[model samples]
Target: MKWPLSKKMETSLLACAIHKGEKLTNYCTDHNHLCCSKCVELNHRRCLQVTPLPLAATGKSTDFKNLSVSTENALSQLKYYETYQKDRMKSLKVSYKEHESLIVDGLRLEIMSFLLQCETSTVNRTHEHMQYTVIDMREKIKYLLADFEKSTIKEKKEELNLKQAPLKVVTNSCIRLHYELFHLHVAIPKVLDKPELSFIASTKCLENIQQSDIFIKENFSNKVFTVNGKSVHNVKMPSDSFTCDILAVCALPNGQVLVADRFNVKVKLLNQLYRVVSHLDVKQKQLGMCLITPSEVAVAGHDEVQFITVSHSQLAKGRKLKLQYRCCGIAHHQGDLYICSPTALYKFTLSGKLVCRLFEDTSADYTVWKCAVSPTGDRLYISSWYKHKLLTLARDGTLLATYTDPALLSPHGLHVTPAGQVLVCGWLSSTVLQVGWEGQSKLATLATMEDGVRWPRSVCYSSTTSSIIVGQWEDDTILVFRVE
Candidate 1:
């Protein structure tokens, strides 16, 4: 079926070089043909140099394909070599497919944000403690105003410091509880609110201690994300007024970045680049939001789909590759690309070809409005806006369980943290909820006011910085919350 260039073509050309009126040499480096020194000294010499060729008759030159085969085999082994390689990168998928439900990326950011808030809260508690110390000193003055004894008043400051440790321990206990709640968030019965009393009252200090309690009750609250001054920029709006999102971003080793701006519909190639780069109004309106993978760029819209290349002079003019649905979010797993939409999710082969619709759950009445896959890529958490509930789905699309709480009136957003914790936002309640897997425990409120919360339109987590950025529709302001 296959043949190498015949040795006759090679040898005949060599013999012609020698016999057809040319001198011979031991090597012909420049001409790449056998030639003599006489040929070099002649016009041929001034024209080219002579170099030696490998022994053709001895199968040296003939083994070129074998050499190529050897290199190909070496490369294949390299693909699996531990020191030389890692697991093949999957498609920059829109979904994780079966890997949808391990650890959630967004939730990890929240937990990290919560952790940061913890440190700030602790500092706030210490400040309150110092203020109380001053109050205690004043109380001793008031008590001795009538008794007027130096030794009696002197016991107050020493005793207050000695008693401070237990109060610190109680506050630490609540902090621990908060951390635990962030992990296992389910709406359980409220805790007893067994707040610790930092100051104790004896007959001598009764009135003063009561005042301390009143002061603490009035001022005690978690002090975190008390923003002094923060700013944000690089806001972009799509031509069709579609909501844009920063779907995915990765910083290169050189500090360059590739960002997938989904709604504005562009994969922006960037360096340390400008701080704010808005998307230009794309001219080719044939189909779909444009999303670029590391290798290929695909133009997609609500009703049309086409895969193309960036280097091509005109992507709209390039060969169009057809796809089944309007693609949305994409994710990368073990060498396959997964894409998601409001109604469905899909997997694709490496060749820009459709593999299959991996997740398609169209109930009789409602459709999935939003979904997020866990890190290990084994499960998916799907949310239905119409039904006001959530479903934990197996990789194969089986409904494993439904999660909801009476307190969850309007669940607008959902995320799973790396530690297997679920975070949800309630629009009507204006609160963020951390719920447990089995729906038995919960942090009834996170970062919401006692009166009520305004509807939070969208939320994202910055894992590198460990912060949660939420967009509040009603407040017309963005809130950055840190995790403890």
Candidate 2:
């Protein structure tokens, strides 16, 4: 059947998009698509109510004016939406700038506040030092004057005859005192104004304070501990096949303990009596664990750190932080995470942001094995497993001291008690030693091979139960030392 086609219609309408050089002649009512003969044969062969364009439009009541008005209204609405989106983009830019400025200002204020605190502390210490110096000087002067007054003329002449050695000694002492006082007076103002100098001075002062504290604790505090009792608890689960190699132990405030089972790739939670209550299986082997909060803990895996929560004695896995470097040991201090690679130690935020690399020793692979922070968060203790040494670092990564003892062989685990006593276990020697707070010397030998501490891998002190929990390698049982 031949249909009359107008040339004007052919010139005005577009060709079929799918079939090149073919006009859209038929309409498919079912699919609501304009189709050419080839499109109908290939794509819409079963579409119902297919009609030619002229037949479809022949008897329809047309409304050209209303359709044109509706088209104009739709275009206007689209343009208005475009304009509104552009305006929203501008507003977002403005808000971003404002937030940036606020963040920068807040950082500046924080720095200023820290500086002010440092200045005030430095000034107060300087004043106290000056006062002590003046008092000492006056006391020495008074003693010298009294000695002269009490001496007879014959004694004075005899002393003068003896080359006046005592007088010369007194004179030199006074000169030295005067010089020290003068140096302090000249150095205080410069240190207060300079940030770097102030920080260094503050660190030195903190060290001195720590040393003094250690001295007092050793001499006056009488902190003596006798092993009240020892109990061994097995943490092997029934679903485990291999001998449990417990690598790390963490104690919470509520007397619960979390132990990382390296052989089974699980973190087990223990009740107050040190019995396994619940456990969470992880994908990777966990090497270390530390308490992030009273009810939260972080487990250090091979390539990431996983956070877990404990509620009502049940264990639940939380978020995971993926990292580029391997995480062997983990410690938390003041919302900052101290992660240990085999040869380096890094500081990171809780949200997976890297802060800085605090320390690194690439001489050996297991040189930087495990870490622990002091209760005050000013000192960091790292165990060098291969070297049989312990490294003490400041908050800013300064190596304060390195401690080595004959009893401490292949130190693996480190923990600081609430009273600031450091406890470290020797993996090779099968011994646990109590190190001083300053990390200068070993205070006491806590346990030995005879005490059944074999290859102790981790150690933690629980203030809630007043016990020392020790995790061992190739041992199914953990040792708990009750101390008074």
Candidate 3:
């Protein structure tokens, strides 16, 4: 009795049915089948030529390899889309909560105005209306975001999994979608539940959406900077005898600027025209300054951080945060304060509680002279005046990169723009250079000595007028460059 062939062995043999005892060695491409050479010769002599089985198998293997690569790319894209959606959801919640707070604060201001007018009945009605309106608006947004998560976002995710080409087609769609959502979030507060304003907001949102779409099509190129004009404004006060030493500059949301006058021991506010409109005497010499709110600023003094508020073009002293370390430079991100001593950088809460020592450089007395946080709050930059270096750090105090340039020497001030460009000024070089977001390379020389940037001590960017403000050492005037 013949030993039964194993199923695997029989499959490997792959004998042709029509050709008895003949192994299949050729593939008929036209008919798409495997057959013995004898069978091909007998049945397909006039037909298209047959290929060897190995050659046909090689071609099929190549096709499968191409398919595998495509699958991997599609999977990678889907993973990215998943992460983007999750982040967008988190941002949505944060933005809505912030807008809600703004609405409450705005209503309170309105109530105060009503009280001043002595309209008791109107105040009561307005207060009650505001409470009801805020509740209604919050509920609307809550439901809207819930519906969006349950419907639009979820449906898109499912579609991405089901179809691969569509994922590629809409890979950049999130940018436009984010712009639309952000525009709506901004417009909601301006609307105040008014129908006419809502219509206007919708129109403006459409325009922004269109612009975002155009931007996406262009592959989000870097913005080109051109100097549109330049001007100088003297920040020296009539009461001060010493020349101004503006060590740091902070730009507010309402087109106003605040400069830390180290020599005069004052924090001076500049209006839209770059003229000093108001000043607050901080007893000790001030160093770095940062915007705490749209109407408030925190100036770092010798050993304390002084908080000042701006109202109706006037400056008023507020609370002060006393630090254990000398406060030479200060920056704010989210709810945390980054205060820099000459040799160390510390993170503190608004109430003066120390969070942690973020960084320290004891090599020199002024190794960490000034600090600034990026808009996203992920990266922190510190200017080392003595070392002539810019150190970038992660939020957790991990050193990311150290940047040095010939155009930048004795870097005294660090300012991260809303667009995430890092602007650093060299005190000794009298130059202002824009560094990349990672603080790894210098992107451009924004201003030089020829551009009237003399002994630049601090740099700030005002988005409202598209201008760069440079504060100088021992100079009564600050240089402002309007750029596009």
Candidate 4:
């Protein structure tokens, strides 16, 4: 029995096998043209062998099952390829969208840095358009794959009646073939390499901020601290063989003071008028110090604390306290000294008795340095130098909250104001930031390098004189800011 090629099949195969609305009826074996009569007359005029279509078809019966199986197998491979390409396209869409989200999030940080410096604009039109283009292509691919389900691949399956009792069937084979031949070779790279987004802000707003004093004050959140150049009190250390790098300072009730000259390993006593009275040399380099009592203070070195007292208008050394680990910062609260090492915080008595190792950070990158307790002694704040975080802990050293800000860079000194505000010295940024107890908000900046403060390593509030004293890293000058 012979099944003649239908008009639809002629239209489908016309581009390569049929001519002028005529179905291919004969196999011109000599010319290899399965052609209509017109094609035989025009191209195969000298052919020696010509077979009727049904006779040629009959000869191919033994291989019909093999031909159908091979075609189905090839289409099956195409189906798998098509599905993979479609999934990859969807993945690319999802991936690019995630990338766009991340890029915008990072841009938000950049925008925060530019807040006081410039004027910002809305999202870029070109960036949004490019993102939409990718989305549109993904939708188009989805619809195209769906439309392909009705094409020759599926139609051939039904025409051969192999859909139910499948002889190795393949699905969406045409869509797969189209993806490999066209989309993979042409579309993917362009979509992947499309320009993302770049945020641009104008700097003209800075001048407007300068001119409007009220706006400037309001923009910085009402607590704007300008440099009191005149109120800057300095105690010039004598030019001696020792490097007089003032790193820490504390004020006493009787108008006297203590200064930690770190490189020189000496703690200098200052008189009521910020004049140097006497210097007590220590065995190790003095880093952080706090007032333990009205007449005495405790200073921290690598692994020891030297208790010094102000007596007879001179600096006198008292009992030395040794610890198992190294000490970096010290804070005094309720007669107990809270000390910080590079990795842990410890509480010890005045007579060098260890209370407890309060907290140890073994989870992540720990760079715990300077620490301070709130006025109420309810919260302990620690500055992590490398992590760029200010950690607020409970009195017993339980972790409470972690604070981070773009303005906070290399935070070193930790000082909690009498009002429970945490003042931090951003060493690299050269700005002193006063934050809240919860580390949730920034209150104000007490001083910056514009106030002649250079590399401030330690900061302490003096309730006696109502002033905040700032000490530097390798410089001699100590800045005293009158906190209004």
State each model's CA lDDT, in order: 0.42, 0.74, 0.73, 0.64
Q: Write the per-residue lDDT of candidate 2 for residues 240-281, one digit (tens) a residue.
A: 978999999999977899999999998999998899999999
Model 3: lowest-lDDT 10 consecutive positions: 215-224
Candidate 1 segments whose C-alpha is farther than 4 A from its true place: 1-275, 278-322, 328-332, 350-352, 358-360, 364-366, 406-421, 426-431, 437-457, 471-478
Clash number by candidate, in order: 53, 0, 0, 0
The residue pairs that clash in candidate 3, if any, are none
Q: Quick one: ranking by lDDT, best first?
A: 2, 3, 4, 1
**Per-residue lDDT over 212-327 for candidate 1, one digit per residue giving the tens place of the 0 to 100 score:** 23322222211122323223323343342444444333322222333344445554443333242333234333222222443344444443344544332222334443556654
The numbered model that scores best in lDDT is: 2
What is the clash tally of candidate 1? 53
TM per candidate comes to: 0.38, 0.57, 0.58, 0.52
Across residues 1-484, which tens digit of lDDT does each residue of candidate 4 receive?
1244344432433322336557556666675446678877888777888766656545231232343333343333344434533443444445445555565556556545543232223224455765566556556755654565445345544543432222222224335343333321222122222211000000111111222223212322233344343354455566445546777788886667788988877888877667887888789988788888889888999899988989867988998888887898899887888988887889888777899988887555447788888654667989888888889898788999988877788788887654454688888888888886577678776677777767778887664555677888776667777764
Stretches off by above 4 angstroms in model 3 are 1-224
Question: How far in Å is the alpha carbon of 357 misplaced in model 1?
Answer: 3.9
Question: Which pairs, if any, clash in model 4?
Answer: none
Clash count in backbone of candidate 2: 0
Q: Evaluate residue 161 in candidate 4 and report its C-alpha lDDT on the 0 to 100 scale.
A: 48
